[model samples]
Target: MMGALGQSFINGITIGSSYALVAVGFTLIFGVLRVVYLSHAAVLAACAYIGYGVIEVTNSAVAAIVVATLAGAVLGVVIERIAIRPVRGQNHLIPMVTSISVAIIIEETLRLTVLSGQPISYPDTFASTVIRLHVGGAEPYFTVGQVLIFALTLALVLTLRVVVQRTWVGRAMRAVADSEDVSSLLGVRVNVTSARTMALASMLAGAAGVLLALSIGAIDAHFAEPLQFKALAIVLFAGLGSIPGAVVGGYLLGFVEAFAAGYLDTSYRDLFAYVLMIAILMMRPQGLFGRRLTQRV
Candidate 1:
């Protein structure tokens, strides 16, 4: 039983790390822009397809990931400049509605383009099974990829902390998050900062897309929907604008879903995500790391 639990814990971390990456991206965008960016998932899925094409041509996973990241970054820049910029300073709902429309368009384009009712597979390089750490004295070993996922997650968390706390760009981003008006007054180039934030968020999404495609070994348009909701849940639960919160929230949600599948009904795994979201909202509306809202009467 102890061994079983250990293995399960490892599995949870592996899945949770991916969740954390997605959540981080969501939170980054929210921090600087205050936009929900519902289309981020479409960007992820579209990049994965682009990665798939790269793999097909070069027969290399690394090459494919590079191409995908560049494609995703460019897409993010275009979307922010074209689709999102027009609605800037309008009611928040206007941008959100625009994002939803863009998401639909992206999905439809994906369905009609590279992902026409078929699953795209990456090269065999991603198919090799790596050995994960041993647990339970002798049984049920996890794979290397799972271990990599957890390690990569830790690395990402550390990188984010260092970036935010140490870099000039990080300070500008924080300044914007704290108060865009003040940031602009300080000559921080608010527009540039916002654009960079969007690009950075999309880059993270691109990396997550690569890992996700590798883990699943397949890519399709429909697969993006669940990840989209999952990422949103993580960001919401982690508290808007809090990077560490996003990490913690992602891991928590991932573990809950995994354990639910193990102990409760397998079908209840996803249902539990929403249940937890609702419970958190009812009990603590601000979320785990979210700040309390203040309003003037």
Candidate 2:
């Protein structure tokens, strides 16, 4: 029984770390730009496919990740330019609709081309190699890739914190987030800040895709779309635009899912976080880490 519990804990952390990565990306964009970015899942899926292609050609996961990160950053800029920037200052819903349109276009393009409208196996994820020291068991507690995911998530998220809190670019971003018009008038480059913010967020998004692809070992054109909702739930529950809260919520969701699947019906796992999210909203509308913002209509 103790062994089972320990294993479940491990499972939760592994799964949750990936969720945190995805949620952080979503939260950053919303926190900085106030854009829901409906096309995030499309970008993730596209980056995964791009990573897969790189793996096939170079037989190196590192190369795949690099290529996918660049691809994701570029895509983020493109979407910001086309779907977000043009719709800036318009009704928020308009940009959401435009983002959805961009998402649909990207998904369809991948479906017809690289994806071939079907699910495909992720090549050589290296899931079996144990990287941790043995703890008197034949098998190690965690695999190399899982450890890497955890370490990489920690590093990337910490780096994001430093970037946002310690850097001049981050200052511009926060200023824009506070008030774009004011920031622009104050000589802050609003466009550049927003573009840089999206690129940073998209890099995390792309990394999440590749990491999850490695864990799940399979990908379909639309598989990531459902996960986007999961990430969104984490973001909402953690707090609107609360990156750290989202990270914690991601791990919480992972634990919930791990235990739900372990001791209860598997189907209910997906519903658990959402139900909890609604409950949290009812009790604390500002979310676990979000502050209530007052705006004049």
Candidate 3:
């Protein structure tokens, strides 16, 4: 039982790292645009498929990953320029609805063309190597994929943190997030900042899609939906625009699901995210790191 529990804990951390990556990307878009871009889920799914095709053609995981990340970056700019930008001018809420429409369209396109609406086995070549881990009286094994996921998630997430907190682009993003008018006056190109933020966030999503595909061992048009919702839950749990908070929330949810599935049934795995989110909402609507508005009377 202890060994099983320990394994679950490890699994949770690995899964949580991916969750944090997705949540941070989701949060970044909200920070700049102040709107929830639901189409992000579609972008992530599409990138995973793109990666699959790349791997199929090149027979190289590295190529797949690179192509997927680049594809996501391009799609981010495209969506920002085409779909979101047009509706964004109308109202902040308008983009949310418009993005949903875009997401649906992308979903349908992928289903009809890619799957004809059926799930397929994900490539396991990336995760074929198995390494045995020595523990106290319990031999917990590790896979190349799991180790890769943890390492890449840590490195990428830390790199993102540094870029956000210590770079000119980070400053511009923070400035725009604070107030577009003020940022513009300060010589921070607001439009450019928004586009860059989208590209950066979407790239993370792209990387995450590959990691997710490697971990899950199967792919489908809508497989990313649950993960997307879980990412939203992490975003809310960490607060609306708190990138660090999202990271923490991602790992927390990951552990939660891991333990729950370890001791209980897999059927209840997805249910806990909504329950946890609801609990967080009831307990702290502002989130763990969210700032409350203090309006002057």
By the TM-score metric, which is better: model 1 or model 2? 2
Model 3 over residues 1-297: C-alpha lDDT tens digits? 767777888889888988988999999999877888887788888998998888778777678778998998998998888777666646777888877888888888989998687876766675646776667777666677777778878887888889889999999999988888898899999888888988998898888887788777788888888888889878987899888899889998999888889888877877885698789878888898898768899
lDDT of each: 0.78, 0.84, 0.84
Ten contiguous residues with the weakest lDDT in model 2: 131-140
Ranking by lDDT: 2, 3, 1
Q: Candidate 2: where is the Cα deviation over 4 Å?
A: 125-141, 293-297
Off by over 4 Å in 3: none
RMSD of each: 2.2, 2.3, 1.7
Best model per TM-score:
3
| Model 3 C-alpha lDDT versus the unseen true structure | 0.84
Superior by TM-score: candidate 1 or candidate 3: 3
